[model samples]
Target chain A: MNASITPITMPKFGLAMTEGKLAGWMVRPGATVRAGDDLADIETSKITNAYESPAAGVLRRQVAQEGEMLAVGALIGVLADADTSDADIDAFIAQFNAEFSAGAAEEADDTPPEPSVMDVKGRSLRVLDIGHGEGDPIVLIHGFGGDIGNWLFNHAALATGRRVIAFDLPGHGGSTKDVGPGSLEFFSSVVVDLLDTLGIDRAHLVAHSLGGAVALTTVKNAPSRVTSLALVAPAGLGPDINMEFIDGFITADRQKTLIPVLSYLVHDKGLIGRKMADDVLRYKRLDGAVDALRQVAAANFTDGRQTDNLRPVLETAPPTLIIWGKDDEILPSSHAANLPDAITVEILPDTGHMPQMERSEEVNTKIRAFLAH
Target chain B: MSKKSYRQAINEALRLEMRRDPRVIIMGEDVAGGQGGTSGVVDAWGGVLGVTKGLYTEFGPERVLDTPITEASYIGAAAGAAATGLRPVAELMFVDFVGCCLDQIMNQAAKFRYMFGGKARTPLVIRAMFGAGFNAAAQHSQALYPLFTHIPGLKVVIPSSPYEAKGLLIEAIRDDDPVIFLEHKVMYDDEEDVPDESYTIPFGEANLTREGDDVTIVAFGRMVKLANEAADKLERQGISCTVIDPRTTSPLDRDTILDCVADTGRLVIVDESSPRCNMAADVSALVAEEAFDALKAPIRRVIPPHTPVPFASVLEALYLPDAAKIEAAVKAVMNHKVTEAA
Candidate 1:
């Protein structure tokens, strides 16, 4: 392996991506590239995302041509120091290609972990359990109308040395669409049932948006079962929520309309790409999906005010860390204030309601550190 | 998401919907079989080919009801149930058996809303297995989607793959109007990556399985698979082709079909049904009427002859339009040219 030569491979933008097309190259051959700089435009089934350079070097060769589709981890380009000879660079490219082809073949044979449907008190729940280690485990609960896929960026990162489980709530994801009353209490009970089904006694509950409210209710209801709480712009923390986002999300059917609504979830509106909005629309179009979403909104956000006030959970709850995005239009970051001084709170700047996604690195680091303690 | 066979996909759709709403029920012959049997066992045969297997154990008998070998009474009963309250998914066993229950489907379920001046809604889905390949003979194999397509108030769906089956079946169950969901019996074992989540692909929307420039191939049900294979084979010969699966034949995606034909300047329709008055003829008439000026070559349809589906393996193989037939059809249309009036 050459230390100076760096391989810029096809990046996997999301969990579902198996292959991507090199739509175009942002940095041409002989161009100086730095880490985090856009190297190429890789298009996946869901969206076209800019492939960032993972190393700083001079772009020696664009091994994969524009518009050529390649499997994830396939060598798309090569980077090396400017002084590197052509023979050395050629050798590096050849070696990388040989290994990449073999790796691609093995990957083709290795299936990704599939989400399973469990009978949680007779309500079908879809859960993805990944990674394994010693610990109480990390239970991820997604927000309103969101599925386990919402944690696509953070779940693997946080599961380094612990069992991390992410599940679709009753009415979301692959779970049953029948949302009984769609209240926080109802959802919390389902979560409890899931934990019971998994035979997990105690686990750190990492929740996002409405899931935060559900986690709070769960702690208040059954404190012993939860090890810790990591709230991300939770519902019960405030009474005010952006009703427009909820309504738009539930009603918007087409890509053009849904894309703008998804923009509210992140500070960088560009993150609300075609594939992200398409995924939401596909979920919404499912039979009983919109109705379940409506029920959840009516029960949780009645008349633009959150019905649940779980602030008391924070006062006497387990070691809790509250994370909120300052640019969150759905739930104001100010709610992070006026909480018990005993509870540690971090308000992320330049991030919206979904800090776990926008600032996934920071959010994952914070969560791992909190869980460690 | 994971790879699921067409059988598993349909089963999941029915299971998910039944769990979601108590009003959604399954009724069909041997759907949850072994009722009143010597063995005293339940769920013996989950439908003839086990497409509805494991659902009975999950949902139980009340929702996953098994009916007698009576299509008329049971299909009629399904229509009545849908009108009253429950959204019933009645399995017709074989699409050829629709002849036994056409009055209930075409007259009762299909005409209820219009005849009653829009006061009634029949949220009924009649799933029937269609197409030939298993040597199931004439009665057991017949792509009769055109019958439902001709009806005024019916929505006909013929899913091409496992993924499409799940979504379209879910959509059919949730739809207010009567829907005829035809499953190709031979395709039950075909597998694809299907999301476990409940999703719906809207009716009348065509799925472009492959995009190309030289020709456009419109196919339905089992024919879509053959068309794709033919397109791939043709691509190697330097002649590219677009393969379109008009998922729902009745609410056919005419615009997509027409647009693709215009782009490619040639058309080849691959239909598994009999030649006369089939989807191929319907689509041909549509293109000729809407896109005559765009056509640079004559339209061609690759379909089974007017004779009944044969019983023997060799004859049956010839009876069904395979990839060779589709490729030849595409090549014929591609080679076609406008002649000067000599």
Candidate 2:
């Protein structure tokens, strides 16, 4: 309760990240830290990211050790003003641990996140709706071979202002593997229908890769329904694509083979962690995912090249911001060059195809800025 | 509807299950191949032996899963999904590939129901090609039903022929418990009258392939075919034999074994797997323990030597417990020294 005393607790990177490994402390004990300062490096199952300080204070106690894993909201370290005594911080830490443990137990006893499946037309779609607020809301459509978790890093970040919705594209995640026609139009209609099912008149469309293409198609078809567009390394704008990556991703069944193929997605190949690859493989193992992926790939990428050209659509309507990774081997960054002056394209260097995952902070900032405008 | 191979029957069983139940799913590497190929042709290789052929086309992608060769994740996912809601049928491609995903099948799926205090029902089925005659050598050609039968909560089924294949497979798919349905790779082409409509052959029921009086011949999977052959030969020699195919090993028909032993008074069990702790030894032990008084002679077991399945034709033939060896075992059991009215 003290004004100067600040609690440095565990941070949740993504919605699914309930716990994380305290890899190591960046700032040692007694170090003076300001808000947004790198306090520690936390490793989640998906990726490792630096834990930023929430308040300006002197680091009094490094309670969590390196390699120690703790649930989100569990105190790892304590921060207080330089004038605060050691006894006060110790007492605070003890109280915090007790309360955190009690809270975790209460949460455990509480009902878990209810994942509901809805029948959209004939196909079954799995959807997770979180957060609630006024305003048009935000619909998160993940890219090719992505699910709701693809927006794990960005969804909550955007949810602070409005209701955030994320779902697995057909044949991608928990959603139906029946990608009817597996085309941009097919997916865009599903997204549109999902919005209708959720009773939302209009929403900010945030999408990645193929989802971006879908978002563009949605806005093109019904521009009045989409308020804003956040396209992350979108597909339809590009001619050159890494067919090998797409092919390897769909074909590689074994862990030994898949690990290498997944590595192509990120510049820091390490980001394509074992669990992520395993998750994709698990989705691929689902009844219809392979066939759906194939149909989708064929419909979208004919001869290893994207079939849909949405540059014209993007140029027509809806505030569109194109964010691409300069080193995006999947869909080369050069595609972002000749985009119409109406569309804003930001190509970040030293990043791969998955800018949302690799450069989450930068991508989040851009999205936040675009939404704000 | 037309004349279908045993392979096609199994495929139809899967296709029918997928259609009947929305929860039922099929997954395996190359089960529906050509995912993102240059030719844009998907579902090219329905399966390694084309057992799952045209399934992807019929059911589309959602129900017929083509997994990446990552057996652990997919198989484990199948177990996890089955535990959750879906009834997943995972193909290990060949029974030999069980080496990779055995942990998922044995530790996870098999134990989920018992370990979870009967609250969990892992209605999962792992279909794998087993048995010899494919010249697939040591790795691929293994009659490993014994390994699966040893595990509790795991209902192991090795369909002897196409008739057994379709019914048993349907039963395995619909079963509440996890089942390891082993199909004889050699018998995929072997035709037998199979009903088109969905039907389940209950476990623990022994199919009397051949009935006679001189000796009781117990066999399983492909060895059932061998035992039938041996029975025919023994009959021609005036030494009649009853060949009993205990359809499932886990829910083994102990009553049938005891009843058969009581009738024949002489038992000869044939198992293609190695001699050490094989099904032959298991049935022999059962007859020795339960039907000891009914026995007129010693129980003889015809099984392969305790060694890896050989590659060479001669060595492989010797390693496998064939009809000739089974016939020899039947004769040996029939000629065993009869003790004075024990």
Candidate 3:
């Protein structure tokens, strides 16, 4: 019941995460803290990441031990003004625990978000639209072998102020696997049609890897629809690509084989965790995913090289920002060097092909700043 | 494009196929585990052996479906889905689990095209972990491809290594006919250089792993591994033997088998399945009928006795045919002299 006291809870890494283990605590009790500072290390099924302090205060108490597991949003530690009493902190902890447990129970009754499949132009596509209020919406298009959940870390973060939309491209996720010709144009048309179905006039398009090509194609085909473009380590602008990575990704079937292939996506091989690899394998197990990927692979990267070049289209488009991983192994970082000076380019160091995943915080910051302009 | 385990190869094939076709879906118990649990975790277990890991996250639940333990409904749904608009790769989990959903696979998926007067393409792939090893006991292990090979409408694929696994699986995914893709549990970790591109190995072409003029040895699935082992041991003893991997059982490369039989004038078939009505019996029948005049010795079959796979390691080892049994069979075939010194 202390007004100055606040609780530091176990943070949710992504939408799918419900619980996280306290891998380690970064700050000790009584230490001064600031919002956004690394407070603790939380390990989720997908990856281990540092939990940031939500508010600035003094670290009053460590309620959860380093090794204990807590539900997402459950109290892991306590923070308060230096003047707050120990008794008040204890009472606050007890009250917070009770409230947290009650809230979790209430949430247990709430239904999980159900992804809807829409018949967009005769092809089935899976879409997840989160958040509702005004402003032009932001649409997320994932790269090759990626689905809507690839934005699990970014979607909700960006949705706080406006509606954010993410969908599985045809042949990638829950979308109709039959991608006609499996070309960027085919995917770009689907994105525009999806916007039409949702009644959106103009929106900011954020795309990664192959999705980057789709977004660029969308801008070229229907310039009025795309308000802004955020391309991350995109494909169409590049000439050189690691066809070995693409081919390995499409062909690998088992864990021993896939683990090494997936390791190429991130600078930290550890980021290519068991769950991430398993997720890809599960997608590949789907009946039509293999054939769809093959068509896409052939259309996009024929004979181990990129087939499309959209630098000219992108050079003339509305405000654009190109983000590349300095250590991107899948698509070489050199591709980002050839961009027009008008196109703002940010090459993140110590990152890999999946800078959006490996260095999400920095990437998010760049994206936010670009969109603000 | 380097050495990969048999497990890695199969996983690669599934990964590639799923990436290629959006209509292609994967369904099985725990294939993408943690469905409807209190933890709110999805994709908990990729597969019993971790084969389906990483897919649920990449493709999401709708495409990489994690079905309930009830095999009949899902397997039948797979068949239904395939016939309608999807290419469903339903994992039966294990070959032994086939008992729970054989009707869907055999009666529905295997019969649709023919019953429909050749107007359908049931591009359904039923992937099941097969063979015995790891002391998994009776319920978890069984090499049941023989049951599928007997059916007329089904195409049976049994890949020997990682390279074969990727190519054959891609082929199965692309084929219009219903295919039963069997992965030997024991061979999953066995590595070989597998290509990264989407390429397929044509069915019915027997891969001659080793060639020799002394005797011809044909094997299936795990037996092929044993045959290679036996061939290697025999080579040291000055008795070289040819080892052939008949990758597909239904389209049993009878021509290849007969040609080898005629050239060597002696035959030995190593089949892990129980003796009666198996690939061994099938090959033996082909040689007996077609190459009756060229036979210099009676055909020898190294197979497990007609009994349930035992649980104990010692008993299981005895129950399963090994390189020793294969070597003995080859020697027996080679030792025969047509006229006893004529």
Residue A298, candidate 3: Cα error in Å is 2.3
Residue ranges of candidate 3 with Cα displaced over 4 Å: A28-32, A81-85, A365-369, B1-342
Tens digits of per-residue lDDT for model 2, A281-304: 656655567788889989999987
Chain B, candidate 1: TM-score: 0.98
The two-chain DockQ for each candidate, comma-separated, is: 0.36, 0.02, 0.03
iRMSD value for model 2 = 19.1
Q: In candidate 2, list every pair of residues with a backbone clash.
A: A253-B68, A253-B69, A253-B70, A254-B69, A254-B70, A287-B64, A287-B65, A288-B61, A288-B62
In Å, residue A268's CA in model 2 sits off its true spot by 2.5
Candidate 2: Cα lDDT at B43 = 70
- Model 1 agreement with the true structure over A1-373: per-residue lDDT tens digits: 8898988888765556688878789998999988978898776765455677899999999998876777888899999999999999889888888887877776676656778888888888889998899989999999997988888768878878889999999878788899999999999999899899999999899999999999999999999999999999888987899998999999887655787888888887766765677678667776678999999999999898999889888889999999999999989999888999878899989889988777776788899888878
Better structure of 2 and 3 per TM-score: 2
Predicted chain A of candidate 2: TM-score: 0.90
Query: Between 1 and 2, whose lDDT is larger?
Result: 1
Tell me each candidate's RMSD, in Å, in order.
5.8, 22.1, 17.7
Question: In model 2, which runs have C-alpha deviations exceeding 4 angstroms?
Answer: A30-34, A81-84, A110-112, B1-342
- Maximum-DockQ candidate: 1
Residue-wise C-alpha lDDT for candidate 3, range B65-101, written one tens digit per residue: 8787899999999888888988888898888988888
Question: Could you give the CAPRI-style class of model 1?
Answer: acceptable
True contacts kept of 3: 0.00
Maximum-lDDT candidate? 1
